[model samples]
Target: MKTIASCVQEIIISSPFLEEGLSREIINFSALAKDLNKPISNMLRKPVKNGAIMMALRRYQQPLNLENSNRLKTTFKALGDITVRSNLSDFTFQNSKTLIRSHSQILEKISANSQIFYAFTRGILESNIIISSSEKESITNAFKNETLIGSKDKLSAISIYLPNGNSEIAGLYYQIFKRLAWENITLYEVVSTTNEFTIVVEDDLVDKAFSVIKRLKD
Candidate 1:
């Protein structure tokens, strides 16, 4: 059976901003319950008193970071390396049947150089290619016939090597990203793998972004 606490937890966890507010004790419990009253009542299949939902809100604990804090700290301490690449180009192209062919052509033209930084992230309706600014001309030549959605220049990337198997640990990413968010850093793109997390930001903000990420273990 779904208890009031379960329903409250479900609602809060779905919105990170609300969860953060609750954690910081900045949310007014009664007001929150007022807003959540109908939803919680619908969830419980019965009318729930707003006061009871408020009580549940007060009782709800953040299951994400409290237990995982120490483990996340350890993982941060063991972060392998912080790699920063500059003068990057970000190319976003609308998805198309011919998009993959264009990508293949670009790879064939440039993958020979092991020194350059290159990354490609595909989304449902679009895809992004981040490469050294020097490759801008090559990308243009390859995607000339395709739909160029948007692009940005003077970008930089920060790739943090995570400890092995960090994927299994909940809140690892939240802890890492929360700090950057606090600093008001606008993330252009975020790419990650099993053991690595990379963020793309404007060149001017790279220093502050790097500092925020570096201090996560501190």
Candidate 2:
């Protein structure tokens, strides 16, 4: 059986945006009580009042601490060299030795003319190759399979170089994603390496995204 305190704590921890409300002690008690009453009724055999839920919330609240806040801000500041690249294209290839050969061939041709970013997961080899509109035909022809090309001028990439000692920190990516999600920014794709993280978004949102990241430093 779940107590009101445990239930309220679970809700706050699971929701990144709601965590702030908990910190500020401004969460809606009525709404929370209503949400939990049905499920908790099965366990406790009765409905609980908003006042009881509110009391449990206050009693079990986990306030944000200065150490964690300082660590996060430091990590953000250490993220040096935030760069945005435009006029990008994306290609997703099925994972195979043939795909690797095709990728190499395409890379040779576009090495001098464009910037290439690629990643390999379990079954897909995804590439976001930034090239000029005039060079698109030459690049596309190099691949044997159908390649998915994105809007020529609409896509943009934002790359962040993480500071040393912060790349391995837990919840680092969550902090970045949470800010973007809160602003309703749609991420086209995400690429990451040991010390760098990159996200592709519409060109229009580049500035807004950059601003959101910079605010983490403050």
Candidate 3:
């Protein structure tokens, strides 16, 4: 089995679509191998560690089809290779009667409960804060520490994971959001960590948002 790097090199070489130029030459493994004076055989001998090479091939084979694949590339290029998993914990308020307010007001109230808030930048809204006991502490703590360590307003946050700090994939979030915004769905807060992204929305819009995301995902 050939390694991923080598496979990528070969794929680039095999693709006539890459064009004839320095940029094309740079991505081509044979050229790169010669330029760096490395053994082409050595590079091709190793199987791809992850699925990056295969991903690249998929991209060249079909441009517009791999909506998710393009997302993976854009994100991987920006954040590096990362593992994304949906967080299972739910958010719920102690009282179901908490008044809905503007983003600033919501942040202020949530901030009073804790210091560290869950934040995310992009992605779809799945549901309203379902405040189960398991997530209360984190929620409460975020409220207490309302002051997020950023130049912008850091009231409440949506915690997100970034496998390797890749921001290019952030565009995928933008893509999903464009349609939502068109439909008048407003996003309140965003926070990202290392692995996943989360978006907070108004309680009233939770169900609608979830449906949109479900439709897009499906």
| Candidate 2 Cα misplacement greater than 4 A, ranges | 24-26, 42-45, 63-69, 113-135, 146-153
What digit string (tens of lDDT, one per residue) describes model 3 on residues 77-139? 443222222322333322212223222354565565653233322123222342323345545
In what order do the candidates fall by lDDT, top score first?
Answer: 1, 2, 3
Better of 1 and 3 by TM-score: 1
Largest lDDT belongs to which candidate? 1
Candidate order by TM-score, decreasing, is 2, 1, 3
TM for every model, in the order presented, reads 0.74, 0.80, 0.31
> RMSD per prediction, one decimal?
3.6, 3.3, 15.9
lDDT of each: 0.89, 0.69, 0.43
lDDT of 1: 0.89
Tell me the lDDT of model 1 at 216.
73
Residue range 45-72, candidate 2, lDDT tens digits: 6777767776776676566667776777
Q: Of the candidates shown, which would achieve the greatest TM-score relative to the real structure?
A: 2
Backbone clashes in model 1: 0
